[model samples]
Target chain A: MFDRETITNDRDPLRAQFQGMKGKLCASPELKAALITGTPLHTPAVGKRVHIRRFSKAIAVYAMCALLLLGTAIALPSLLKGMDPTSASSSTGDHDCIPPAVAMSSPSQLYERLLSEPNVVYREVGTIYFQDGSVKTSHVTEMTRRGDLFTTLNYGDGEPEHVRYYDVGGDKPCVYYNRNDLWFTSELRGDNATWAHWCKAYMAVNWLEDEHYEKTADGYKFTEEFIAEQIEEFKCEDAEGTLTFQDGVYTLRVVRHKEQFREEPCESVFEIQISFGNAPEIVLPEATICTHEYEVEVIPSDHPCRYGDETRYTCKICNDWYNEWSPTVPHNIVDGICTGCKLSEEEIGNLPDDDPDNEDHSDIIYGPYVEMSISRPSMQEFLEFYTVFQRKNTAPIVVTDLGDQKNSITQYHFYGGIINKNTFPDDYDYDYSSGEIRVPIQFWYSFYYNCDDAYFGTYDYGIVAENYTLDNDAVIDLDNIRLERVSTGMETFSAKHELSAKGKKEGEIRYYEIYSGENRLMKFAICAVASTEDSYYDSICQQVVDGLVKLG
Target chain B: MKDPQDDRAQIVENYADMVWRIALSRTRREEAAEEVVQEVFLSLFQKERTFNEEEHLKAWLIRTTLICCKHYLTASFRNATISLDEVGDLPAMSEGQSTVYEALLSLPAKYRIPLQLYYIEEMDSDACAKAMGLRPGTFRVRLNRGRNLLRELLKGEGIDV
Candidate 1:
């Protein structure tokens, strides 16, 4: 009935073009040579999304053997007293490669970075997933981003919601939004209303819990409690969220909160797609009730022991008012016992112990430890020293900051005073013997994604995987590491090692030689931005800790 | 004495064009297509895969090309490159009459990919669907839509389809 040659007849419009394209394009010389040589013609590119070549049987064997060998060397438990950030001594790690300006970031850092983008869009798709594997997608909240300057259209749902934008025309950083004429503006220009509002709207997850410093081989995976009260419609309770970070960024986050006290269980789920598409402009409607005059009702703050005096001002009419997280009230210490919460001085001393894995604090601030302000780099400086850029305060993986530096090779910074099972020994039901890492194996899995996200947030370039990795002795002398730039560069990270991990992380493949007496294990991570496969000069990635790790 | 035949080199030579064309259809830029081809073959050479059948190898190449295309065209990649540099924009190209190539290029990406694989590579609907990660029924629907769209595009240009 049909033949190949006859089917490619002139009757088909594509016949001529296909043949033309075929003639013009051919295999390049490098490709042919690489095929013959069995070497890669081009190094694989990194950033956004990456596909892992499934390890073969032989390679898997070799990898297992290597992990076994590595296990012996890295297993020696190391200890470091963590800096409480408010009071107590600075427990800055003895990291030698600490950048001058940037601090290492936490998983929360990704949200901060995404929210900071001017031209970004996030579609918070809420789906109610049941234990039976059925799902009911209820609502979608689409937030439009335009960096600090881009105009945003809040709708890809056919119906455009009221657009929000920043206006330099009026005054300070002001966000104007109107939903069907009920217009309002944020006090972000004068106060911290903008940041506080962003905190409430998105990125409400507090990563300062006990989950930090833990390790996930492929990506960073962490779990935290999901407040059931946040969702009124779903009526969910005892919610817990498991977030999976494939590379350095979280690709999937599944939050499971059950409907209140039901024998048959269900969970609430939401997937946020960080859209890079340009925001279409919409004319703002005439403002009717833009400003809200709240009847000032002062809710007495909670004790410094819990929630630090929860004081909030909500407008009498609408949900509009100034919100702030005031510092913890001074503890009334009389004869070594806190009069307010009855916590003893000796008990507080025992809080900061030898365990180097987690910070025992949750939502509680101890003493007068204020969030110290650090200087961030200028925009021009940030762009200049991006990927593969030179760093100023480079150091050997040696004991430079040996003076009282906490050698706790950890991935998390635990804030003190949180009344958790570990923080308060009052919970007899708590198991102290479970999941304690006294000798934490320190490694740096900083994602120096100075490179662009797949135009937006949908793609996962596997480069984010093994690309930015550091496998070394857990402790680094961090006191000398200064903060110079806050941008995500591979260098310039300071104690601000913990803007919640270090200064702007970059992608230069920096090596830290680890010494175990006779044997030397070199741990170095290459930035996906700096060491893109296109930048073929970064042959050191071949010595990736996850892949073909070169050992001597 | 002749050296052992390099299977990798022979394989690359065989499929580089198909992979590049499929990538070109998706990405539209020569550079992006070339880069995608490189990644596909490099992935092939690096993996310790044993392809028993010729169709299986072809399927792998097609699948890989599709994946690379999905990852290749991000905002970061666009910003990283100087320009898209489409084939039509080259100085030597003729102008005036809209060629079948231009008409085909004008279609949406979803249709263009299936059209190229089904018509250009002469792949059946089932094989094309499998490669594109689509159901056989869905693939048939897309193929019809593509044909209709192409026919309309050509008819508008005063060409018989």
Candidate 2:
């Protein structure tokens, strides 16, 4: 039994110490300085680990609705061009590859069909040896009843191995059966490595058919035969370039002029080859090994990349490396804690001159990081200013450091690419179509350094959501925006907008307009350095556009 | 009836002492406890459009304050990135010893939150149960356990209740 009165009689004596913390918090020298100076204080959102928490229900609903509509709009042209799943383009003499009359079904139904009926009879047998001195065998088979959709399997003799189904326009290895046409799919599985690794290889091989893209800017025009030749010619040894072996890693630098790099005109162009082990499997794609003009500095992490660990953290940029996406050396901090990394061009130029032991360094870059670069349009500009942050530009998002102690680091992440929904043909397979307006969002933040204390990254606060309606239709005419100093009587803030474009190669800027409590204007000016477009991806961008439309 | 956003901001400005006191009672550490108050007010500001009236927003703030305080206790164990080594440098008062305060700091997260909500927050046991997201019977059990632990800790330090 407990003494009820005694138990209930607890109180906090330190209550008096915090009599006015809220008011004081607003007036604190640190927050006040940040509010006025506009210089970020601590690990600014810019280079921090991109921790996108689940959106609130209202926001999620608003965004999803917009995206769904956008997807439908962008997809209509391509969908119309799709002549019954099995039919080929009437204009081209090429064989009608798309299957028709494919009965569309839910993913669950497809899974059940593969499981119960053995209807998806994939039967290509292969053996794989595991690193742990073990061997396993696999067989793959396919079945397409209505022609377009194909249910497929890659399994052991009788057991259900990794199974999948593909709608006609699905991405590679996912299978693309012509709707009403006869299509065949092959499957292979072996314990050569893990299931995931083997699956990656199989998918890569089967989806190896050359894809022909009409010449756009820096694009490739490939056919099945050309792709097969490229695949056959591919040898870790005969990569046709200079091989620099460093730290157990081998790198081949392949050069290509801006124009010759692809079908479309290329502005930023460079190519290279890199390999690690004796296995040709270690070879990376041409895009992976290429180096660009900027430098990237990956924040060092004390935690080595390992399984089950959430390796989500941020890195700092030294400000001076602003506006350049460069290669990075992943590292850890002094506290034995792992965060993000900064990327820089300088780091790539000074790679530890070729060493055989650099095998670990050659591992492929994954996960998300920021890419920072500065661009002054260098020409006269025009209307509603907007900032467009891109997730990827051939090379993914990279971060650079501004040596300025105030805003030490920032990042530009490869947000993913945007398609001109207007330009995308209706017949193209599963594509994200959209009008010219786009917003590929990215994060930017900085830390307020304390010499007496150790702080791993910069810290500043800002909004994180799919999209925000501009006060005015200010995005189209990007020239109206410019960076300037902002005064709020007691504080100051610096403003800037960032922009990125692919087709027309135009720029946009973003700025903040401050209004007083009395509805009187306090500050109004164009700003720069931080923005993204809504046109980055089909599935996701469509929603942002919808959000904008809903707001409208 | 002023704008709800402005009204809620006023409640935060006016009742901040009440919120911070409850937070300090639970967290014991001042900076983190202060952060809890800031989060509560910031949340009120961000969600200003949702509340029906001023009082409703106040209640939400108070509830959020308790949750934030409880979160601080659990968060402290896993995210002890900020070192507590310097906490000893602060000077002690010449009046009564702050043994109970120290004792509360030593208690586990589950016990600390229940005791603070009931005693320092001035909420009834049922309200405490609601705020902590627990059943009334469970809330009573937690209170007993917390009170016993505090007594024992203070007893060890030669402090009479």
Please report the candidate that would top TM-score against the real structure.
Answer: 1
Label model 1 with its docking quality class.
Answer: incorrect
TM-score of candidate 1 relative to the true fold? 0.32
Fraction of the real A/B interface contacts present in each candidate? 0.20, 0.00
- Candidate 1's DockQ is 0.10
Q: Which runs in model 1 stand beyond 4 Å of their true positions?
A: A1-24, A38-44, A47-552, B1-5, B75-85, B88-98
lDDT of 1: 0.35
TM-score of 2: 0.26
Model 2 misplaced regions, further than 4 Å: A1-552, B1-9, B25-28, B49-58, B66-97
Model 2 docking grade: incorrect
lDDT of 1 by residue, A98-174 (tens): 12122212112212323344344434322222122332222233333343432333332234444544442332334
DockQ of candidates 1 onward, in order? 0.10, 0.02
Clashes of 1: 68
Report the error of model 2 at residue A113, Å.
Answer: 22
| TM-score, candidate 2, first chain | 0.18
For model 1, how does the per-residue alpha-carbon lDDT over B1-64 read when each residue is reduced to its tens digit?
A: 5443466657766887788778777777766677788777766666455565778778778877
Tens-digit lDDT string for candidate 2 (A413-450): 22322222222111111112212223222222211111
